[model samples]
Target: MNKPIKAVSFAAAAVLAVTICTFLIIRQTHEDVLSKEAVIKKVEASYEGKVTKSTQSKDKKTYEMTLENPKGTYFLKADATSADILSMNRVKAMNPSVMTEKEAEHLALKRVPGTVKKRTHKNRVATYIIQKEDGKTYEVKVDMQTKTVLSADQISNKDQQKTPITKKEAKTIAERETGGTADDADLEESEGTLIFEVDVDLPDDKEATVKINAYTGKVANIVYED
Candidate 1:
């Protein structure tokens, strides 16, 4: 009976030793990992701003840094393990004399008039979510400084119309109309009209926007930019 008891005690001691070694190894690996300050330097190199805030995730595997500069504020996420940049977004600083929400809404309505569902102002950008008569949603972003429409995108649910023209066909039409290569294309709705907004790259570093009707497969509008 004493021999059996001694054998059980030896096994327990071995298990404890293994657990201690594992913990030590993990601790050493963590200590050897890159520090947060090192990661912040990498972000600053790209953004060139004052560090406003820094935080680590609950898992301690990633870091988020907020930096501010004269141009704008930026949020950057980096992987702690490898200090790799995961994501970045810039919010242009608001100018006190910039257009108001109402003004921005009016401007956006001029471009694509519809029922305003939501309006948001942040970091000098005003966004209007508009619902057209056909129940499609459009998201329009306006730049405060220029008081011009920055981008307009449709965020409505997938169209249930199975007979609509395919995206490839839309791009071909856009390319033919603009005499340029279609660099980007997206299907969107404007004023109850389903259209494809395609960005084309033309000669001499020029750009063109081509809007093709999704249902009719016709060129709705084409505008060139220098």
Candidate 2:
């Protein structure tokens, strides 16, 4: 073949290879990207809230989603083609509610049966942080306006010492010290120490609050009141 004709043939082959490679890359990307329906489902499944708004970026490579849960409004960004949550931020903190906190606490206690740590009302939602007698913690979300328990999730497992005394042991110690009937037991961690505060009903309308070290079965103090 002549020199000019051979050069033109080589150039044409190079162009064809580039085109084929580009086409394959595009096809692979399309196959890998999540579908519209799938992206929506992924967002809903991963987040515990209603997705109020979802839209793809101008480049169509990212999805911006707004979620509203019992906590507050959240802004999230997910990969357009993959089920990966890129970023999540609380954009707006819900305004605190004034009333219905006690009502919410009642509903949460009925569900989890624990001592109330704190109650927070946000955007008509009430969240109760409760700790059980065994040192396990839980978070209960309640709809404050409607006075309903939305969710009860255990946040932590029981933190029991390797050779710690049980509730019965604590109760026995308290009753022995006070010479009264043990009525209630509350286990809590204080300054890296597990303390069991037992309520004992004394005779003649008297009461005793006993604080005992759970690990050693030793009575820390006894507070007596009428």
Candidate 3:
């Protein structure tokens, strides 16, 4: 009977030792991982914006941070242990008092009698691209808050050679490259080079702007909403 009691006690001691070792390993791992403050710092350094909110996943393996600046808002995800950026998104802000896209289009038409090709809103500014009846394309920017035209410039001449790529083709290329559909596409000229400016709607409620070269049908530059 004494031998059996001793055997039972030894088994219990082994089980307790294993449990304690497991707990210690987990605690050490947690200690080695980056802390919440450290992760926030990493995110701040990468995005240069004010952190508005921070949240951790239920599993405690990931963190989501919201950052804001004068340009727009950013949503970022980071790994809890490594503090590595998992994803980042940007969204443009819209003012309630701003004029609607249609209203801006009407105002642009009043200035130049042409068909509005595209209208985009960014940073409280509405840009309207119009193709005139004389076959010239013009870009007009309107201040949404003041309801005023900021600038209007002719981008294309009627006698200029036709572009190799169409606006629709440029939009498709922009969407494929960014993995987002374009909300607007405008043909504009920069330094004598014609390009298609496409606004893309990304996943996670974010926005992006892509510029495609009309001659090469390649992406010139892509920028997030911010």
| Candidate that beats the other on TM-score, 2 or 3, i.e. the better one | 2
Q: Write the per-residue lDDT of candidate 2 for residues 63-166, one digit (tens) a residue.
A: 88888877789999889888689999999977655446777788889999977765667798888767678766677998876567889987642634322478
For model 2 the local lDDT of residue 45 reads 84
Model 2: CA > 4 A from native: 96-226
Task: Give the residue spans of candidate 1 off by over 4 A.
Answer: 1-3, 91-226
Count the clashes in each prediction: 0, 0, 0
lDDT of each: 0.79, 0.81, 0.81
TM-score order, best first, reads 2, 3, 1
Tell me the RMSD of model 3 versus the true structure: 23.1
| Range of the 10 consecutive residues with the lowest summed lDDT in candidate 3 | 155-164
The candidate maximizing TM-score is: 2
Q: Model 1, range 38-57, lDDT digits (tens) per residue?
A: 87787777666777798988
TM-score, per-candidate, Cα-based: 0.37, 0.44, 0.39
TM-score for candidate 3, residues paired by index: 0.39
